[model samples]
Target: MVRTAISRVILGVSIFAWVLLLINPGHIMSMEHCHVSDSGPSVSSLHMLLEMNPIASQLTGWGLMVVAMMFPKLIIPIQHIYARSLRRTRFSASLLFAFGYMAVWMAVGLLMIGVIMGLHLLMPGSYLPVTGLAVIAIIWQFSPVKQRCLNRGHNHLILATFGWAVYRDALLFGVIHGIWCVGAGWALMLLPMLLPSGHTFAMLVVTFIMLSEHLEHPKVPRWHVDFRAKLFRMIVAQIQIRLKEAQE
Candidate 1:
C-alpha cells in the first residue's frame, strides 16, 4: 500500500511536468528567441482561437505519450485500458511517456522549423496545410487496412480487463498500433511538407488536432466494429491454413 502511494505521487509529479512543458512550449522557445518581434499574427487573434480549443492540445498529446510509453512496445490494448478509467498505472505511464515522446517530437519539430524558416526567408511568402489537411485526414481514417486493424483491436479490448483470448499479446497490440498510427498520423506529419512554406502556425494547429483525434474516441459507432473482426479472423485463418499446407 505504501509503495503504491509512492508510485502515485511520483506519477502525479511526472504528469504535472508533462502538462507544464506542453502548455508552455512557446515560453521555453521564447527564452531562446528573446529578440523575436511582432512579425506574426496579433495576440488577440491567437487568443480567440485558443478560446475555441476545447481540448488542450499539448496536454492531450503528453497524456497519450504517457500511456504509449507506459506499456512500451504495446500500444492500443494498454491504451484501451488507459483511456476508459482512472487507473493509476495508466496515469503514471501517461506522465512518463509524455516527457520522452515530447523529447522526440521536440527534436523533430526543431528540424522542421529550421527547414520551413529557411524557406520563409528565401520565398518571403506562401503557406500550405490550411486547405488540404482535412482531405488527407478523411482518406486515412476510411482506408481499408487501417479500419481492419482498428476493428481487431477494438473487439479484443471490449472484454479484455486481464488478457486477450490470443496467445501473443504484445505482438497483437503492435500490429494494431502500426495500422492505427498509419491511419491516425503519418500523413499529418506530411502536412508541413505539403504546405507551401511559412505556415508554421497552421501546421502546428493541424498537428495538434491530429494528435487529439488519435487519443480521443473513434468517430464511428460500437455496432460498426463487427464487420472488421470477422474479416481479421478470416484473414488469420487463411494464413494458418497456408502454413499448415506448406508443412504437409
Candidate 2:
C-alpha cells in the first residue's frame, strides 16, 4: 500500500514538475537573479515591480522548485503520516505537513536571495561565487556534519493521532524534517541560483544528488566518500522485475 501511494505521488509530482519546466523554466530555475540591471527595466518601474511582485513571484518559483526536487525525499515521511492518520484525515494531514514543509523552504529562499544579493555586490555576473559554492557543496557532501544532518532527517516523530494534536504533529514533523533537509542540501540548492545559465540542468543535477543521498541508510557520522547510488540500483531492480514479469 505504501509502495502504491509512493508511485501515485511520484506520478503527480513528475507531471507538476514537467508542467513547470514547460512553462517559464528559466525563472522557475533561477532565484538568484531577481534584481534590476541597466540592460533591464528602469529602476523606478523595477522597484515598483520589486515592491509589488518580485518577492512573491520568486517565492512561488522557489516553491515549485522544491516541489520538483524535494518532494521525492518526503515520500517516507508522508507515507508515515498517511499510515498514522485516520482514514478521513490522511489527505488533510498530509496537506498541512506539506504546507509546514514549504513554509520553511520559502523562508530559506528569502535568505538565499539576500545571500545572492550580497554576492552580486561583491562580484556581479562572475562565476566565482557559483564555483566557490560548488566546492563547498562537494566538501559538505563528504563531511560528517552532512552525514549527521542526513541521519537526523531520518528520525520520525511519535505522532499524536487525536484532535488538534494530529494536525499539530504533522506540521511539526514537516518543520523539523525541513530543517534537517536544509542542513543537508542548502549548499547544493544554492548552486542553481548562483548559475548565470543552465539553471534547469543545475537544478536537475542537484536534485539527483539529493535524492541519491536520501536513499542511504543513516550510519556513523564520519568523513567518507559516499556516492549513495541506491537510487540507480533500485531503478535497475525495478526494470529487471518488469522484464521478468513480461516474460512470465
Off by over 4 Å in 1: 1-18, 25-76, 79-125, 152-179, 188-248
How would you encode candidate 2's per-residue C-alpha lDDT over 95-181 as one tens digit per residue? 888888888998999998767655654465779999999899889989999999999999988678779998898899889999999
Model 1, 55-124: lDDT tens digits are 2443344344333222222344445435643454444443333344344444444454444333333332
Query: lDDT score, residue 157, model 1?
Result: 34
Best-fitting candidate, scored by lDDT: 2
Candidate 2 error regions (>4 Å): 25-28, 31-53, 240-248
TM-score of each: 0.34, 0.85
lDDT of each: 0.42, 0.79
